[model samples]
Structure formats: structure tokens, C-alpha cells
Target: MNLIDTKNQLTEKKKHVEKVANVENATFMNIQLHAGEEVAEHDANKEVFIIVRKGKVRFIVEGEPVDVTPDNVLHMVPTERHSLHAIEESDILVIQVKP
Candidate 1:
């Protein structure tokens, strides 16, 4: 059993990304973004799942625009192109599943 304190990690300012877990089949990352911050378009090397913890985010997935809010989840397949932009100060959890 493992317990992760997401709130404590999310509030930290020294690092934008906090690694939650890294196992043989998957990796978990917690990411925080200030308003107007963006993660440029890129392809995922592994299947990815993103869970919005707070605020809102805009996602460009395969040329389609999608908006995500708190409690929303987005899933992407390996090699899919996507980008993220924070609509407000936001917190997100990213899970990458190895193929």
C-alpha cells in the first residue's frame, strides 16, 4: 500500500513537477501551472492519462480543442499529439503507462 499527499506536493513552488510514483508499468507525475503557462505540443511516447485537480486547462489534441476543468480526466494513446495551457492556476496529475 502506498499513500501520496497530493495537496502538499501541489502547493510547493520550487518544482513544477513532482514525481508521485514510478513503477515497472507506469509513472505518475503531479504538475502545477500558473495562468497562461503552457506545455507545447508534443507526442506522447506512452499512453497518457491526465486528471485535473484544480482550475481549468485547454488542451489541443490532434488539432481539436478541448477544455478540462476540475475533476475532469483526459486520456491519450501513445504517439498522439497534444498540448496543454492553463486557463487559470491549475493542478494536474499525469499518468503515463508504458507499452
Candidate 2:
């Protein structure tokens, strides 16, 4: 089994993105963002699942804003265009499933 300590990856910097795992069918990433930090718009080339681990974030998907928090999970189709803004200092786990 593989274990990851998500909290240990938190950073004081504006943003941090790290690949934690890459298996045959999926890739896992840990993203830490300070309050007000933003990830620019981009296309999701593969199916995606995003889990907010701490604080909150606003996901701009196809020009629509969707607020996400630790209590929720966000999914995106491969063709979706999206961007993220940290509403507060936040930690997020992103999983991309390969086709």
C-alpha cells in the first residue's frame, strides 16, 4: 500500500502542485494554494476528480463559477475548460483517469 501525508505538502508559497502517484489508469496530484492564488484557464484532457482537502476554492468551468469546499468533490469531463481560484488557503487532491 502507498501512503501520502497531504498536510505535510502544504506550502506558504502562492501555489504548489506535486504528482503523488501515477498508476496505469490514473494520476494523482496534490495542489496547495494560498488565499487569492489562481490557476489559469486550461482544458482537462482527461476525466478528472478534484477533492478539496482544506479551505475553499472557486472553479470556473466553461465560464461558470462553482464554489467547492472540503465537503464536496468536483468532477470534470475530458473536454471541459476550467480554472481554479483559491477562496482561502486550500489543499486539493486531483485525480485524472486515463482513457
Candidate 3:
């Protein structure tokens, strides 16, 4: 079994991104962001899933704004253009699945 620890990686002052696992069909990542921080818009090459572990964020997907929190998850189809803005200090897990 492979074990990944994420709690220690969360930070409050700066943006943090780490690849926690890379397996045959998927890549797993952890992302932390402080309030007002944003990830520039980009296109996803694979199917993508973002799970908010804590706090809240605003997701701009294909020019639409989506508010996401720990209560719900976000998914995107391959090649979808998207970006993230931290509404508050937040932590999230991102999974990319290969086709």
C-alpha cells in the first residue's frame, strides 16, 4: 500500500502544489492557496477532478464562474479551459485521469 500525507503540506501564507501520486491511469495532486490567490486559466488535457478539502474557491470554467467548497467537488472534461481563485484560505486535491 502507498501512503501519502497531506496535512503537513498545507500552508497559510503561500500557494503550494505537490504531486502526491502518479499511477498508470491517474495523477494525484495537493494544492493549497491563501485568500485572493489564483491559478491562471489553463486547459486540461485529461479528465480532471478537484476536491475541496478545506475552505472555499471560485472556479472559472469556460468563462463561467463556479463557487466550490468542501461540501462539493468539481469535474472537468478533457481540454476544458479553467482557473481557480481562492475565496478563502483553502486546500484541495486534484486528480487527472488519462484517457
Candidate 4:
């Protein structure tokens, strides 16, 4: 089984910015954000969906900031310039569709 404690997965990949995934057409990632970890602004070719699994986050999209916490899901358009920061230690499920 591929059961994993996501919190531990974050600890394991904390130093790396990307992870190898097994999804197609779309990519699925169990992402971890250390407290204060900030992802720089970038644009996507297709819509990107984020689901906060643990902790808190702030989504900076198009120079606007959206605060988030567990159970919150945010979807961003392909052309929107977006970035993310972990306001507290966080675990996020990210799904991106490739156009």
C-alpha cells in the first residue's frame, strides 16, 4: 500500500522543491510547507487546485492575498500569477492539470 503519513513525507522532502509523481494528464502532489516557506510567483499553463490538509497558508495570486487553512480549497486560473506561503507548518494536496 502507498499509505503514508503526509506530515512525515513533508519532513522527508523539505529540502526539495519538487517531487516525482505518478499522475497523468494531471499531477498530484503531497506538498509540505515549513513555517514561512514561500513559493515565488509564477503562472500556470492550466488550472491549479490546492487543498490544505493541515496548518495555515496565504495564497498570493495576482498581488492579492487569500488566507487559507485546513479544509479550504483554492483554485487558480492558468494565467493567474500565483504564489504560496506557509503561515504555519502546513501540508497541502496540489493538483495541476496540464494543458
- Indicate the residue-level lDDT of 12 in model 2: 49
What is the lDDT for 70 in model 1? 73
The lDDT values for all models are 0.87, 0.90, 0.91, 0.78
Name the runs in model 1 displaced over 4 angstroms.
8-15
Better of 2 and 4 by lDDT: 2
Q: What is candidate 2's lDDT per residue for 33-66, written digit by digit as tens?
A: 9889899999867999999989899999999999
For all predicted structures, in order, the TM-scores are 0.86, 0.92, 0.93, 0.79
Q: Model 3, stretches more than 4 Å misplaced?
A: 8-13
Q: How close is candidate 4 to the true structure, as a TM-score?
A: 0.79
| Candidate 2 vs 3: which has more TM-score | 3
Candidate 4 regions off by >4 Å?
1-7, 10-20
Error of 3 at 42 (Å): 0.4
lDDT of 1 by residue, 35-85 (tens): 888988998699999888888999999999999887678999999999999
Clashing pairs in 4: none
Candidate 3 positional error at 4, Å: 0.3
For TM-score, candidate 1 versus 2, the one ahead is: 2
